[model samples]
Target chain A: MMSARKIIETIDIRKIYGMGEVSVAALDGVSIDIEEGEFVAIMGPSGSGKSTLMHILGCLSRPTSGQYLLDGEDVSRLNKVELAAIRNRKLGFIFQSYNLLTRTTALRNVTLPMVYDRTKEFTPEESDEKASRILEHVGLGERAHHQPHELSGGQQQRVAIARALVNDPVLLIADEPTGNLDSQSGEEIMTLLHRLHQEGATIVMVTHDSEISAHTQRTIHLLDGRVETVVKNGKKKPGKEKVEK
Target chain B: MKPIEAIRIAWEAIAKNKIRSFLTMLGIIIGVAAVIIMVGISAGTEAAIQEQITSLGSNLVFVQSSFTRGRPGQGPQSGGLVFDDSTAIQDEVEGVTAVVVEQYSSETVRVGDVTLEEVEILGTTTGFPSVRDIDIAEGRYFYDLEIERKQKVAVLGSSLAKELFNNESPIGKYITVGSTKLTVIGVLKEKGMVGNTDYDSRVYLPISVVFQKFTPSFFARIMGDSVRMIYVELDEDANLDSVITQIELLLAKRHGVSLEEADFTVTTQQDIIETQESTTAAFRSLLAWVAGVSLIVGGIGIMNIMLVSVTERTREIGIRQAVGATPNDIRIQFLTEALLLSIVGGLIGIVLGVGGAYIFSAFSGMRTVIMVHSILLAFGSAAIVGAFFGYYPANQAAQLDPIDALRYE
Candidate 1:
């Protein structure tokens, strides 16, 4: 494959909790890179710092010390306001709980991101129309006006995905997107993610289930706040290109 | 986020909890209402008193005798205002148009078979009609020539006529006061109550008639027809201050005393109105301070509820932050909710206050005047209170850690 542009690159990132002697390192000198259009999964047991790494990568939190570059621009030292702008313009997130605003209709939930979009790419009417179209594309055309409480777990997750995709983000981070759904619904969600990947959307997922991680092109396994192995399709990748300590 | 979007979000949040929101706004509602109503009643009373003073006459000055010199053990000094003072004011004072010497006594009056006790018997000259703004509904006022001859002619006020004669004409009828027979020469037009002075309840007579019938000849020789008060009318272009000074100097000379030792007090209509207005203004401010306390308590109510709302919606705030909302967006959203609550409450208060004023007047017979500025002031203060009290909770919500908020379940 031709060399791809790096969408995310973390250089020796470290995140410490508390201070002094009792300080705990959640991520210890970890470094990684994700190319454009890559489908990757982060796998780790509880207390392994996978959640902390997801937060840092999502721009929801900053590392204690490190260089994080998104689309080749340093974002590690940016303040909360600048980080929020980057998140609004370039990144999207889906939480494990499908955190849609309660009592809001599905279409409104999908249109929320555009409300904060500073580009003014679409008028309010156009935003509603686009949100409707996306809801149709997600196989919930008739349920656009239904609130989250009225929808099933699978449908709620689909609405969340529609919300995340509304801003045309460069990176989509899903933290166990199907964790709250039943097996059949989880299978459907996996199928939808695969279809999105085929359509050239870069996706990152954090999950504990091996079966869930198996669907990704590459999986990074973490242990004891460090990367334990990098596997490709059940086979180990050749070299650890950027892993430190 | 756009302001419109924040407003919409705030509306939804408030609409979700209708009872609590209304209960929260009750403080503002009562506070604004109190402010409007209290100001309305006080201003109305002031207006009524002002109208009462002005209605007595145009450019009028009142001179009433006051005891300025009296020993601790001895009887009061004999220097007092006499009926001659009115003639001196009319002749000597510049800009003086008319001077009316008046006195009153509570006496039993009998017309035909009807006798009314404690009826006010007023004695004055022919200028009483012009200077006091009184009009004759029928017949005519006692003529000035009648005062020289001490004629036993009288004018009946409209209400006194109604009490004595019912539907019969009181004109040319006989009314007896203190066993002295008098003919009713005129009946006054119906002039309603001005402050506590009811113009339509007194019996008017020529000044000499009252002095001849009520006072002993020896006392008259010494006191020279001593009167109760003098009402002086000035022309339209009169300078009240200079005219008042002239009257003061003239009275001092007539009483054989200096200006400081003068036994009479001179006052214009404006002075009376001003004294009443100052009193009402103090009362208005006292009511405003009381209303302000309730408004402050209302603001605290909003703050308390907003703090609770922020705590309750911690996870919702987290969701908003995850969706790219800045701290300011959250702050604006919550602040807008508080502002909307107060604005709506203020609107309701304005309506209720105005309506309540009218209703209170209708039931209690107290005059109430609603001023436009009071409503605006109440509404403006409500908005300010909402914003002032809303900031802390909104800031607390904005300062919340997004990750920890999300984990708050």
Candidate 2:
């Protein structure tokens, strides 16, 4: 563990809701470390603060107290614009609802992240080319022009995954990425995540399913705003499919 | 984000809600159209007045013979300018080019069993043609020789000729005025209207004949050869103020009185035109303000609908923020939508406004002039209205918190 390069570090972080007498602490006195290129799953009950921790790690919220360091830089005090910049350039997010813009073609939806990255200059044609390539990588090259409603549930999630990977982000944060999918689609998404993990991608997924937890390299379980246990699982078989790059 | 990308996003949103977008722009459309039409009418009134004045005469200085209110009983010793004063001004004034005396009488005119009663018969010297810019459509205007010879000849305005002759040539024809038969030698072309004077519907005769035929019946013969008004034309390079002062002093000296007691009012055409223009300008601004109120109301409508749109798209805004859009970016996107709506509406309003002005002129028989400044003002105001009214709603959208907006029901 000492030889591994740390990518995310939290020192007794806490997030409190409300103020004075009627306050509730969503995350309290929690500390964890995630190393580079590691796939980890966060598990907890409904009110156990796993989602709060994910919000903090993804730079969507600032901790109420203590420190959060990402890639060896303190991010707890960053401003909204700075946080947005980090999110655009370094973090990718996938939501349970597969939040792709309605009425937009798959290729255009995937190109949106690059359009918001102000630091990089991309012409419309260049963004279009890059988006199409990413779409092809996700096996949706034929569905590039299809709108969100035209695609099936599994196909829409695949488009969302392509959007998440368009910016080549450093960390992929997924919250119940397969929650709305059919069982067969869910297995395909899990297999896709496992495949990316073996290719040296850093991933953090939040889910309560133990069956999903078995696919990750390590798991962190939370109980009542604090870390309960950390476990290593190697039960799932490796995916034999190779990516075409 | 780049501005073009923001515009594209705004266009997409507007295209998705085509009916709502058109409804939002309708207010601006009506406002802009009203503004243009008002301006057109105002400008046309000014042009019509200027044309009417110029048609009466060029550089005309009018000396009106207002009878003095003498002390009751004293026989009112000829307290008005007589026809000799017209010759005096023509001879003595330095910049004076010509002077013509005008007197009028209403009489029934008869030509071949068709009679027009109470028709105006104007009297003037042959200077009428060059000084008044009136053209002869048929034969030549009667000149100095005709007037000096006291010839029983008359020139009919083209419309008068049409009424009496029914399209038959009026030149070399005879028309009787009050049982005094006269030959129509020439006809004036269509000169339209000047103030209440319809130049085309009137008849013209020499001052000698008008005085002999009408002035002998004057009240108790107290006014002998006294003309009602005198029109003086000046050289093109002459200063109007100087000419007016010279005539005032000359008339005072000739009548054996001081300038104030001269019993005549001398005025330049410029003074009359200025008075007309000032009145028209005030009316124009009043109409413009009334029209501008509609534009402001339109702006308020835009703001109202924009607020509703922001509320409806709260989740969409939340998703954009989560995907890394800044507050400024959100503001620009919504602002772009509003600006596009107003600009497009303004353009449509311009076309409608100009067309409306044409229709008004055609139906009402009044001229309408569309000035370029009015169009630009209407367009520029619409853009400002969109941007100004759009600010609050766009700010509301930008200030939204990602967490609350994303979780909103």
Candidate 3:
């Protein structure tokens, strides 16, 4: 049994890609639950629907049929506008490609999430202070005014991470966050994620590399649109077991 | 997102491709400029004509023969108004002030040994000074008795007197005109050309002298006693239209023709002004239609470029959405870009338009008046074009599925 506090819960989620003659099941009958303050990595081969699951968890998409409880609310059937509001307030996303606006300064990119955060309604000055703080936290304080092309790939990804954290979201979802980085930069990013996790931030990362997944507290592996196994790296609580699948 | 933030984003996009953006705005610039210049020149012409009409003496109307519109060769040959028609209008029509009749001929007049051939001789009555507004700079005009007695008296216009006597006062002196000697009674004041005809270059005489004495006997036998034109001035409280109707009815009855078939045309100063104004207005409207088409073309140009921009920025859009931007935010950003382009273009066009109007007036000597209303109208329509045309592409950008957009290569 896991902890009483389940931060994310999905009941028998099914996602279909086409219909009838050419139908393909992207994620078929998968269920998962996560606890607060957890660092987990989802791993799978290319056709195994790991990305589709990550998209659903990030509130970027919805499953064809499911019951998803994010912070204990059924959000699977929420409209796109409602999902976008939730994403702005509660979820932060880091994509594989950095995805920073090319012509904008790094500080502006960091402040972008706050621009759409209607619930918090941070004024420009307040948002600027928060963005600068996050940029310094990501170790790119001096590069705040530099455009994306002026920075290296690693620096751009650092800026993206700062943007994701600027809103103080509950769930930090990173989809192949270090996928495009050099080995040295990738290790450095993993160290940063580990540091964030130590500070009690809930993080869900998607990675196919076993060596990378080994650094997480738990590794959930998928095969043929189903959870193959859940590997624990030996930080077990009482009455809780690994490999729930 | 706030509008200023959206405007900043749009500015970045525009600055990325400056040349392309300017080219997209070219049509609007030309359209606005053409509209302003056209209206300016036409309005200026109307003002100038109105001034000329006011100078043509107060409450004046003109009567002339429309000989070309008469049945073929009948008008100039025999079918036209005579001096008797002026008398009839004066007698039969109410609110008559004075009717000045004119008869013109080219004749040789000798003051001394110098013989000036082709001196234009105008035969008019004593009402010439009052009705035609010609002042007597020296002596007096020929009176009614002089006209009735066919007296050989003449009034020299200021320029004609200068040419004939050269510093010598010719009043009360005898000048031989077409084999008949006439006493020069007055030196008329200067009146410059109203159009191509120089009103200051003619010599005035009594109508009886020009009709019964100056013209050859052969001309009298063929053309009979004919009058060239009649200038009529009205009383202060006269109803002009009613007087015109009375004159038309009396003339048609005397000439044995209906009003439709009458060879003479009566026109007031206002009538001539309206005809000229409508012509200029028609030309202006044509130019406006062309300018309007150009503006539409400019709007289409904006839509085309924006659609291309939307395609190019698909990845950017997806990234924005992932960072919690709503579709409305993306739409506003693109729309702002289009509005900026059009408004900036309109402003430049205003500068060009006013400059062009002044330059045209300077080079062509044609008048041009630029009104504030035209500027506002051009700019307002340009903004409307921006908003209207920008909607579709902005909506296309907004309605893109985030997942699919993100996956776009």
Candidate 4:
């Protein structure tokens, strides 16, 4: 079977640092396409350009030269303000550290993206209701009022996930979503990602762990600022590993 | 981001660090309070001085001998003001209503068993009561006939009357001054202290009686009928400058001197008030400037604390940026926090300053007039300072790179 539409299409994207004397290429001659309903992983060792690719895809940083198409819209040459608007309306991000604001309740953390929603798609009260409902979907309804310090690592990551999905973004970009969690919490998070994938949500995750990559439909492997292989996993399996607490 | 959301976020950040925020606001509080209190006191003193000078009398002019201030033992010179000048101003000047001339002396007085030392005795004409705004409390003042006939008549000031004869009336009582005994016909009303002069402690007598009884100085014998000062009162509709010019010209002719070499100086009540007001205005501005410096220091304190907060919350800012907050939004958030701190501090200072003024006035017995403009100025400057000093740090926070900020420790 073939997907009807491509959610992300990049063409030979490169990110260079320092213009004079000695220059460095963080991303070099790498291009990939992600289908509308696919769960994909980008895996690489340190300095392999996986992080730079993630930053460019997440719209947190612009590539030095490339054409980045998000949902059929070219966004590579957009300015900072336009990029921020695109990020707000179409993309959601999950960091390795579960960067939930400290001293803020889980519900407020979930509602934060909507605060910067310039379109004003929802009133403040509607935003609260929508955030509350999403919190319930992520099994964090009971911990909605708890601050980040009051929640465990897995719960904080769940809050972050709920926040990412609150605006109903077209793509979810998760970078090492389970890196900070224990083995059981990591497995639970993988199961949640699988469920979301089964519900026809597009996900792009960046991680170095092969076991975590096994859970996705496809994996893009990077070595030395370029993609080395694109592996299509045959089927999903219940892979379990006893990670250190 | 919406401004309301930005303000809410700013408020949350400020509330999280309540102690630090309050400490930062302390500078603004003291600065505003100092400004209000200083301006209030200066304004009160100015008002009090105006009231005292106006109380002397309305539409009044004082003509004094140029040499009267310095030449003490010399008494009256040839060019000194004589009693005849008062008559000429009253007759020749068109708008003049009353003229009173006075010569002062200090003498011991005795009434029955009570003896008061160094009582101020004023030898004045009949129009002294109207010209000086003094009224009789119990009995009448001496008439022009009494001065012309050289009658031994005296009027005791209210306080002197009270001192000489406790609760009893001093009307018709006899008081001995030097070797002569004069009958007290009237007691002057109680007028409170103005500057250093105590109107109620004085004794008023007919000028003729003083000239006949008191021994003449060597210069007084040569300059016959020379009085100390002449007070002229004009009608309500009179032009003060024109009347002053008329009296100046008439006096210059009588003293047989050129207009530029006139012996007497003429000054109206308005001139004295203007001079005193300009001095106080300068004093008031100086106090305001000193207070303004403290406000600027307070603004610097806000900038310092805001910079520290920006540095401390770098990661939070990065997260916000990742979540789609624009640089403009970040700038507005921090700017709102700074403005809130100063505005709240300014409001508190206003309350404390007004209350402090009243408390000070009660304890120290000094008048303090809390002007509305002073409060507005303090508050306005506080807001401006917050915005002015807050811009740099807010821009610094806005210029932070999200990638580096997220990775910061």
DockQ of each: 0.61, 0.54, 0.58, 0.70
Candidate with the greatest TM-score versus the true structure? 1
Best by DockQ: 4
In model 4, state the lDDT of residue A28.
91
Question: How does model 2 fare in lDDT?
Answer: 0.85
**CAPRI quality band, candidate 1:** medium
Q: For model 1, which pairs clash?
A: none
- Over B1-409, each residue of candidate 2 has an lDDT whose tens digit, in order, gives 9998998998998889899988898899988999999999989989999888866777899998766632212444455777888998999898988888888888899998999999999988988877888898998777778778878889998889999998889989999999789999999989878888888888899888888886665532654577888999999999899989999898877665667666788988888899889999999999889889888898998899889999988877877877788888889988988888888888988999999999999999888999899999998999999999998999999999877777665
Q: lDDT score, residue A199, model 2?
A: 68
lDDT of 2 at B92: 89
Summarize candidate 4's per-residue lDDT along B363-396 as a digit string, tens digits: 9877899999999999999999989888998999
Model 3 chain B weakest 10-residue run by lDDT:
B70-79
Give the TM-score comparing model 1 with the true structure, all chains together.
0.90
The CA lDDT at B390 in model 1 is: 96
i-RMS for every candidate (Å) is 0.9, 1.0, 1.1, 0.8
Model 1 residue B286 lDDT?
98
Q: List model 1 lDDT by residue over A1-245, tens digit each.
A: 45888999999999999999999999998888898887899999999989999998999999999899998989899987887788888888888899998989999999988988877767789999999998887788899999999999999999999898888888999999889999999888877777677677788899998888888879989887888898886422222222211
Candidate 4, residues A1-245: lDDT per residue as tens digits? 45558899999999998987788998898899998888899999999999999999989899999899999999999988888888888888888899899999999999999999888767788999999999999898999999999999989999999999988889999999999999999888888777777767889999999999888878999998899999987654223222221
